[model samples]
Target chain A: MVIVSVAMLILFCMIYLIPGDPAAVALGPRATDAMREGLRIKMGLDKPVWVQFWNFFFAAWQGDLGRDVLSDRLVATVVMEQLPYTLALIFGGISWSVALGIPLGCWAAVERGTMADRIVGVLSVAVIAVPSFVVAIYALLIFAVALRWLPAIGAGEPGDIGDQLVHLILPSLAVGLGWVGYIARMVRASMLEVLESQHIRTARAFGLPERMITYRYALTIAILPTVTLLGVGIGQMLSSAVFAEIVFARPGVGKLVYDAILTRNYPLVTGAVLVTTILFVLLNLLADLIVGALDPRVRSRL
Target chain B: MTVLSIKDLNVTFSTEGGRLHALKDVSFDVPERRIVGVVGESGCGKSTLINAILGLLADNGRVDAGSITFEGEDLTRLGPARMQELRGQRISTVFQDPMGALNPVLSVGRQMRNIQYRSGRSRSEKDARSEAMLRQVRIPDAQAALARYPHEFSGGMRQRVAIAMALMMRPALLIADEPTTALDATLEVATIELLRELQQDIACSVLFISHHLGVIAELCDDVVVMYAGEVVERGTTRQVFHTPRHPYARRLLECDPARQSGRTRHLPTIPGEIPDLRQRPPGCVFATRCDQRVDACDKVPPDVAVETGHVARCVLAEAR
Candidate 1:
């Protein structure tokens, strides 16, 4: 865990050392060369790059993300307020993946080579092959514009979480659709192998109903692999909030960092990056523990 | 009366490639209340023949040319909806692996009760009947075992559970396909004895499929030896083993080391694998594998009467 934190901290410093000047970017097109230089000196950006990087990380450690140069707002405060919205979007997407992926996988497995299974299988493969950003745009155009049922942007007020969730539907679907295909295929292959197993044949020989043989025996064996997917897949689904948040222009941490990087607000960018990296690392650790809980063989090793 | 009468039975599966014949021109009959063992090598169409009789063939599997007459009803012609009524009620099977024969996630009690109630048991009657059947299978700790999953039981216990499940329906005929091959020697004998005991009490006929002629020798009253998708011999177990006329049946018995009298370098083996169904030879399927091959062996062997109840598809036996 400490290694992960230190690794992220080192990466944070390296990104800041890149040659491009964020202060110059912040000053924008209309500013004179003398004025841009003056602003850079005032913000302490004129210092050696290493020194500037150090100060920014120090402020990040102290929770002093500094003010966004353009908005004149505290970066730390802005990010904290937006963090929940991104987390919500991520959770929503993962929930959607789990809700649809498991049952559909089992269904495809039980009804192997059937018309419905074939169609779902093909659709899932298509979902994975096409990028999520494309799915977001198409879904937004269809659901928000063509259908005209949802508000296009924003997480809305605290009390309006349901409406915010409604707005997130298309973007989350775009983000999560592909994982369903991957997880379903994993499940289907497992189910097919397990269904043909000796015990299953033995069960049927006993005159057990088809439903019991399918749901009870075949599905239990099939789910071992699906549970394995859930742990790491959830991390990927939750952490990959950038594209969807950016496309929708939602007030999420991803968009906050986007604004920070553009304005040369180093503290906010470093802080957000650190928090995200840590969250993902911790999420992966939690996944390992949870998946281990489901499979005793791993638990025994621990 | 014959419980199962399969006449000119043929099974063909049309896969993505082309038509593949699985069973061809096979015919046999099971007498009422008797153990009839179908012994053959793997892929000799033993399991396929039984699956066709059970109406449990997969999507691509088809009964290309045959009549499976069970108690006067042509099962091959019965619609799926009509077949379902008879499947768990009057027709049942026990397969190769006992552990797989029951649902891994369900309690044996639940599986037993489900077949009991859904096939027409009331909720109240389901429990009482389920417990009784558990005891009948001789599962120790019947109540606790009933509540446990299939994996919790030993292989022998599981097979007993499977046997109990099959007999719970009190079917007229039970088809078991290599049912104890996965068991240890001790469990194998115990399971076979358990099966015999159950069938003795239930008075149900058994169409037993296996590769072990020794098992058939001990368990079956009559035998049907299959080779390359057709029956090569059928007779009383005594007649088939002692004076087997068909070369394939005789070779099958000759290969069992327990029954071997000579210390030969190698066991007597039927030469080739079961012929590929896609390009079957024009003549007898077994002739390529038969050591008794002659010029006439290239011609289809007619089914010749060897005894009062014995019959064999062998050209050499005809001269006798």
Candidate 2:
């Protein structure tokens, strides 16, 4: 909770400190100097920085993020309108990463020092080395330009479920690319360490079947650290969504925040940042709970 | 009748440096319903022997030569599935560190129930059996312990839980790998006593491995003294302790601090460190430290009969 407050405070200061005038942007170059001054006071931009922060702090608590300077709409409403699309894209990305990453990691650990292990090691490294945006561009070219299997740009129309899903495919793949390498590597390392633990040897000595030994015994312990990684992976997806949304022309918080900053939309920028930070915090808390549930030693500590 | 017999066993471990011969021409037997103790210092192949017999040798280890026969079947030739079936059913192990032996994540009852999967019993029946086994090992609130995780138990209590789990299936042979080494002195003695009483009640043979000579002398009917991957002496506990024939065995007995009388300036110690397995001596593995070494000690000493059912691998014993 403290983290969220601190993050918002930092973001608020950085956004205002930038060389941009919200009142000037709202009134445009044609407006007279007296008109700009009047608008600055009306929007509270003429207030002291501390007073402005205090007002934002109180208003945010009540979910009143003020109005966007350009659109003159409530910033919260603007963010809420685009929230579902960003969330859907992130959900699909996380699901894809876990579904592919876990089995590949298990297979690599089980076949350590074998050809399969080497292939997985090399491929994951290559994937991590290439940035997510590069993967996005390649995905756009191959799937959209050449094969024409899916839409190339923009979020689908409202209330059209099939079109929304079709538009989500390329962007989700781009966001998921970064997570696949990170999660797979973590799972493989964790599995190898767990496999060598003495309790695993004890389980083997007890004559449990190979399946039980690997999945039931080793996997349970191995998956704990990976759970934490997946939490961090969600935050990565959020940041990556900024670029992904821009490339695909999707209606999302990422695009809203980017355009808000470019046009000096202070309320919109702060609202978007606050929502993303809270989501990240919640995801991490869930990860900790899952970890505590999986491991008795940690659970007792908690 | 012998319940388990190992003949001419040889185990080697391949490592980054080279192959290390861990065991050489070792042979012993556990008579039906009898306890046999294997005594040695650290790195004397005690764990290697146990792992080889259990078919749990590490990835780099191999049973290069030998046959481990239990009851009537050869374990080395058995397939993995058959070996797994035999394991925990006919041959169970109680490891030294109880905290490491039991999975901390699993409840005590759940871990015990896993072993009963092949018994074809229902979950509640397995739970009842686990409680009964815990009670057999003298754990307090046996029923409540079933719901607790392994970490909640104290060290001695965990060892008892381990013992209960090992004996749950009524295995024919129990291999205890210094199961009491990690406990306090009082707990150590109590755990050992519990082990003996329970072993008798179950009527199963035991192969006890420990580096502590006192533990071997107290519990073993037959004792095998191992030095540098080789069995230097084998005889009944009484025969070996009273009249040790091998020079190393004689020195080992002298090194026991309990045997020293009051006001001794220094307790006895064998002169040198145990030779590394990578550089085993040309003949007698203990010859480098033996006080009675002769020129012929450079050659492999044959097993010479020192008494009925007693043997010592030494040139001096051969001369006698």
Candidate 3:
């Protein structure tokens, strides 16, 4: 909750720090000076910064995030409109990362010092070193330009779930690629450590099959640390979606925030920031809950 | 009648500094249904001996010589897959730290069930067997304890739970690596006694490893005394305790505070550090700290027979 307040505080201050005339932007440069002044007064842009902030802060508690001066739409409406696209992108990204990362991590750890382990280690390091947007460019060149398998830009038919999924593929990859490398490396390191633990040695002594020991004993323990990384990945994924959405010309919460920031749309930007903060908090909470559920020792500690 | 036999076994670890001779030409046997204790101070390679038999040696540890035969199979030659089949079914192990031995993520019942997967019994039957084993280990409210995690149990209870899990399959031989070292004194005695009773009840041989001589004396039928990665003495517990032939063994017995007869201000301690495995001296490893060291101690010591089955590796033990 305090984080939410801080986010609001930062977002509220961003408008003043940025050099822009919202009234002139809304009325257009060609508008008469008297008309621009009239619009500024009507939109309460002439009010003191603290008074404007105070009004928005109190109204935000009641779910009123104010209206977009340009679109004349409610800030809440714009957020809700673009929220699903952002969420879907984040979900797609996380799924792809986890799907690829975990098994690769287990394989790398089990094959440590082997050719396969080295290859995976190298590939993961490479992916981690390269920025996601750079990877996004290559993905676009291959999948969109060369292969012609996917759309190059803009989200597909808005209400069509299949088109939306198709449109999200490249964007998700753009966001998820780095996370895959991160999660895979974390799982490998964690699995190696867990494999050396006494409990795992005990499990092996129990005459369990090699597969069972690897998956049941080692993987279960190893995956705990990875879950926390995934929680942090959520915030990274959300931010990455801003760039992905911009590159792909898809409108998401990130894209909405990006455009709002560019145009100095205070209400829309503030609303988006608050939502992202809440999502981040919720993701961390979910991670803690999962860890507690997985390990009774941690659960009792909690 | 040997349930587990290790003959001329040598294990070496290739560490960064040098080759560490962890176990040297070690030989021992756990007769059917008998508890043979392997007693030594820390770094004596007692745990390494157990790991060698169980094929749980660390990555760097290499069994350079000899064979470990369980029942009839040569364990050292067996592949990991085949050895795993024999492990827990024919040769289970109870580790030193019960808390560290059991998976923290799993419930006591779940882990027990995992071990019983090969039993091919129904889930309910496995549960019933688990409860029965817990009761056998004398855990009160065995059924309730099943749902509990390892951390929920007291240290003593955890050891019992570990014992119950280990003995559930009734392996032909059970290697207990200081299972009671972590417990308090009262718990230690009770756990040792319980382990003895359970061993008999299951009719399984136990190669019990511990540094605690008192526990070994009370629990073992036979004992092998080790020093610096080599067994210096081997005999029945009565024979070895009543007449420890090796200088190191005698000093070890003397160091036991329980054996003190009179009010002594300072307890007796063996002089000198345990010879480093990497730089073991010529002659006997214990000769440097031997109380009665002579010029003859510079030569390799011979294994001398004290009685029919009793043996000690010492120059003094050898008759002229």
Top candidate, metric DockQ:
3
lDDT of 3 at B10: 94
| CA-only RMSD, every prediction | 5.0, 1.7, 1.7
lDDT for each residue of candidate 1 in B250-310, tens digit (9 for 90 to 100): 8888788888786777776656778788777777778877787888877777888878779
lDDT per residue, candidate 1, A1-302, as tens digits?
A: 67554865686667667667656777788888998889878777788966876776677667676776666688767778877877777777767776787778889887778998998799789877988778778878877889887766666656776777787787677677877788778878888898887666655544456777787667766777676666567556644577788887777877877777766666567667666666667666776786666444455568
Q: State the weakest 10-residue window (summed lDDT) of model 1 chain B.
A: B98-107
Off by over 4 Å in 1: A1-83, A98-122, A183-224, A263-302, B15-19, B99-102, B105-110, B122-132, B262-265, B279-283, B291-298, B318-320
Worst 10 residues of 3 chain A by lDDT: A7-16
Task: Show the lowest summed lDDT stretch of 10 residues, model 1 chain A.
Answer: A291-300
> Which pairs in model 3 have colliding backbones?
none
Docking class of 3: medium
Candidate 1 residue-wise lDDT at A76: 69
Q: What are the chain B TM-scores of all models? A: 0.95, 0.97, 0.97
Report the alpha-carbon TM-score of model 3 versus the true structure: 0.97
